[model samples]
Target: MHKTLEGVQQSATPAIRGPLQVYLVVLALGLTVTAPSRLAQVIAAAVFLGLAIDAVGVRPLRWLAVPVFFLIPGLAIILVTTPGHGLIEFGPLTITQGGVKTVLDTLTRSGASIIVLGFLIASTPVSTVIATLRRAGLPSVLVELLLYVYRAIGTVFVEAERMQTAAKARVGYSNRRAKIRTTKLIASTLFLRTIDRVTHLDEAMRARGYAGKAPATAEAESHGYGLSIGILAVLLGVRIL
Candidate 1:
């Protein structure tokens, strides 16, 4: 048990002990929004910086999917809603030069933000992030959920890879029937496994004296407050500039 715990700790170290590269990237992101008409240049710079940071091989790029998934669609919505002078009119369908510009700007800015966040996830460990969030005053239940979700994603991927490999071994790349069967197997397995895990986790938590309320730790509260203030200051400065 102790050895297993140590192994887990070692596996989690890359995320916890790295230089504050994520923080620096975030600071740069905050500065980019203030770059006036050079916004596109700033966004491009941030993206390159983030990629370079990831290229150091400390963090995997796949971890960035979460932020990109959320940011791209959000920017699209912002661009669609922004008011502008209509440049193209086709009955009710109008495309304004200003709207186009707004969309471009939003896309650039949001993409830059997601890149910075991706860099952070790549550099930081899931354990450290959970610790940070807990320390930052998030409820313990939420922190635990975050950790479980992280682990669950890894579980799902492993299941997927196994199914794919099995399919490939049986049907070479041409077996569409094998591919579909393998995919269904992976999906059904994940769903069942997830349900079982959630049930077991809930039971274990209850057995361990969990109640409806999450206990607050003083250290976590202080860290959360400090981080909240720092983030707010950075955002305010970005808007002001």
Candidate 2:
């Protein structure tokens, strides 16, 4: 299989509007608001804005499970823990307006951020993201680690899917007990398979004059620089005024 860093190629001339551009935009979005009230409003605005961007690229729903997972846990924990005026009561359990407020505020920002991140991940490949960072003068050791970790994630996901398919073929997950056992087996197998892959990869790298650091990448167009500035201006504008 061919390799491309998140989506950044090691070409003599890199393309405009690369993964680095998207990464910077997301970073700016994260920094826009400081207070929960305004931040929550901005987050809602961002979600709407991101939907426009999503139409032109990858929709956030392409990997709906991830956002839902984080979104649920954040609300769940905050509802029980945040202190506020009581909105409702359930015997020993109380639901306060303060708790509800905090949950909404946090979830809005968190969910909006996820929307932006989801778009970036879905549109760009992992290799391109790491490669772009490497080009941005990141430390060699850090870049190498990022590269390996991204590859490992892809490997694990693929392995898990394959095992899941195999299990289904054998009626391995027909019941809850069977499903739990199958899941445990898949996790263990995936771990061993990843370890084996890493060992061979190290050997291959060493054979090819592998060092602690990766080689340098080529330059890309600065076209996205202007685009990023405009986006930041817009985001900050909404947050400030």
Whole-model lDDT per candidate = 0.50, 0.57
User: Candidate 2 versus the native: TM-score?
Assistant: 0.58
Tens-digit lDDT track of model 2 for 135-170 = 667787877886676556445545555677799999
Candidate 1 residue lDDT tens string, 1-241: 3222223333332321332333444455666555454444354445544444534343334333433434555655554555687776667666677777877776666666555554444444454555556655778787787567655544443444454567688774466776556655555565566557666766776788867433432212212234434544654454455
Off by over 4 Å in 2: 1-16, 19-23, 32-60, 140-219
**Highest-lDDT candidate:** 2
Q: Candidate 2: lDDT over CA atoms? A: 0.57
The global Cα lDDT (0 to 1) of model 1 is 0.50
